[model samples]
Target: MDCCTPSAGRPSTPVAAPPPGSGDHRIEQVSVPAQTFAMGDAHGDGAPGDGEQPVHDVRVPAFTIDATSVTVADFRSFVTATGYRTDAEQYGWSAVFHLALTDPDQVIGQMQGTPWWLGVEGADWAHPGGPSDVAADDHPAVHVSWNDAQAYCAWAGRRLPSEAEWECAARAGLPSRRYPWGDELPAAGHALNIWQGSFPAVNTAADGFVTTAPVRTFQPNGYGLWQPVGNVWEWVADWFSPAYYAAAPVEDPQGPPDGTARVIRGGSYLCHDSYCNRYRNAARSSNTPDSSTGNTGFRTASRKS
Candidate 1:
């Protein structure tokens, strides 16, 4: 279900590259050497989660990836150049975590169990908090749909990172570790950005900010990539199928041919041990391509020749 598709349930379109000399953006290109890597961890953080076991190998060619998640400034430039409206805007709003919803008017006031997420109107990437809100120019833009991300990437001369490439960069040098840094979770005054205190209602900003920090606010892994394990969950260019990896190709796997959802990597600040602990390096999740939220965004990669 994690592959590309239109909101109407049609097949997704192939992404295009953005025009040259785009403004209001800083692009840092990192080269990825051609190599083979083992994908997945046999041990799923000492749990029995589906699709995480039966560790396997994959081979890839040399390529380049964006050094960080796409920022608000860069997405703004894409909007300026293309004059495009995001899907969330077209849909009228997006899902907002109840705790992040400080404004009463913005809260649609419905619980999906944990009392954390609420469907709010006018909560798209541009208006991250809702209709009355605006995302900081430096923060990574949120509430962007896969289609929106695809359009932005095309207009930015980049493409969404394939799931394989993304996993490799996230793993960095320590392929067997639990996180980009290591197995241990963030301790008092030790690592970079992440959610602190209680979920939504009482955030202490122990790692730094309650909301999304500016990209690279956390320490970079050995690959020089930042915020791979926390902050926001990034959309990858692959369909979501829990059993697909069982039959995935050993060389440059591209996931299932067709599916309902798209793959998302890394965990978000919303991650919690009791609810969802997907913040681990090997963890993954998925949602409809049209689904957008304040905690979701993406990075890009170029195919190796």
Candidate 2:
């Protein structure tokens, strides 16, 4: 509910990633060198409860991460070979943005605060909005839970990047800039696929999309990472804790040992300045690991060899 999806259930157990080498799940990756950097609201202006304050020093080791998020085609290959079922498919429903829905009958219920989200039956990565709304092959695979992403990584011989690694990668050599490109978005600019006009009501589609865009729609960051700041809220391999940074380890800080919800980074297409303005390098959100939504997806990473 924080960033993208409503909580489906409190799943206490973590799903094991499937065995490696079940499919040809390869992706183009870019390397990020080891470095120390400030890992918080560089401008000291972030949401209150979301906790992007007290800019802290953090260091990460060399690692390689996917240049783009895991697309529908990539997930399809994994499912085709492993016959794996996503959490959404297992639960028989997933959260969908109201504007993305084609059939109202597919909606079973809606969240309390965020009425824009509808719990639709038969909604999964394959059928994002509803049974009729087929996902594009190149679009980021939405409706995928954190567990689902981990399973994909298992089959692909990859893993989700830690929150530290994710933020570090998204920074892409622009330390203090809110966006990977620069400090501020140009007037009437289309840097990323985010809500253009008034959120949830009058979207001008000025950014070429009211929903998810294809990977690399905008220019790559300095490290050649694609769409690092916007498009979808990506799942990272870290538990959520607003106070984690206060006492976190400096070098290669993996998040807290345990948490009810996992951290999500890079606000999604639904993000806007009028409402959910979390589309920045340091901005963060979290949801239940089992929760899935239309605007949430993930990329994979590998430790440097």
Candidate 3:
């Protein structure tokens, strides 16, 4: 099933932001130097249909990427300044994890294949679980689409990282490593935010969170990028293509020339080894430009101008 699906109902009213802190409005960026790195699942451990095969080399130019995924406070600031409405707000609803909802009636529908995802009315970035839920300011902003991320990037004078750049930065200069830290998965609550225990049905929250954790909840990678593998699936600036990696350029590939959906990299708090092992460095996925979900978010990137 698709990670994000559409919902039916009205959007929730935007929530007021808490008092701004020094870090709230600032977008922290880490400089990723120009370098060539292998950019796909050469190890063949990723899901079969995930299109992570044919590991290839890619060179990315120097760029600055956000240290963390955009936070709720950051998105809130943008909305407050621009009065921008997300696709979710425009569509009136977005997909929310069933575990996040308190009231069963709030679920408008369930995704056919991924029944764990509930189409929740009044579920937007502000109300992650529907009208009654409020996202913590420090949490990574969820229920954001690629379109929403692009808008935020425009407002912030940045852009989404290209898929190549994203993978390079995620690798953190490590070559052929399963994760940012190394080959071995760190003990829960050590380096990243991801599902523990049974996925879809039971989340042990062994990482100290059942859902989205604070943006800086984990240690930064070698490039100083925070939560590069987990927390939320980040939208990248590339159209999806299963075979694109084979023909992808060695120097600064930008994904397919055109396609229906955009690339989404890394994984999210919902990922687990049993079903969704997408949190690996070379793993990838995609979704429609306008799709939003409680487990998706994005960070910004920019040329070192």
In terms of lDDT, the best-performing candidate is: 2
In model 2, state the lDDT of residue 136: 96
lDDT of 1 by residue, 1-305 (tens): 21111122223544334444534446676677777877786456523433666678888787888778888887887887777777777767677766566456866654344346666877877777777777887787888877788877766667788888888888776667778777887557336455666655787777767778888776778777878777888899898777877788888888888887788888777665554667777878887787777788888888766
Q: Please tell me which model should have the higher TM-score, number 1 or number 2.
A: 2
Rank order (by TM-score, best first) = 2, 3, 1
Q: Compute each candidate's TM-score over C-alphas.
A: 0.87, 0.96, 0.91
TM-score, structure 2 vs. true = 0.96
Show pairs that collide, candidate 3: none
For model 3, the superposed segments whose C-alpha errors exceed 4 Å read: 1-25
The ten-residue window of minimal lDDT in model 1 covers 1-10
For model 3, give the RMSD to the true fold.
4.7
TM-score, structure 3 vs. true: 0.91
**What stretches of model 1 exceed 4 Å from their correct place?**
1-25, 46-50, 109-114
RMSD of each: 4.0, 1.5, 4.7
Clashes of 1: 13
lDDT of 3 by residue, 192-236 (tens): 788888666888888888888898876889999889888889999
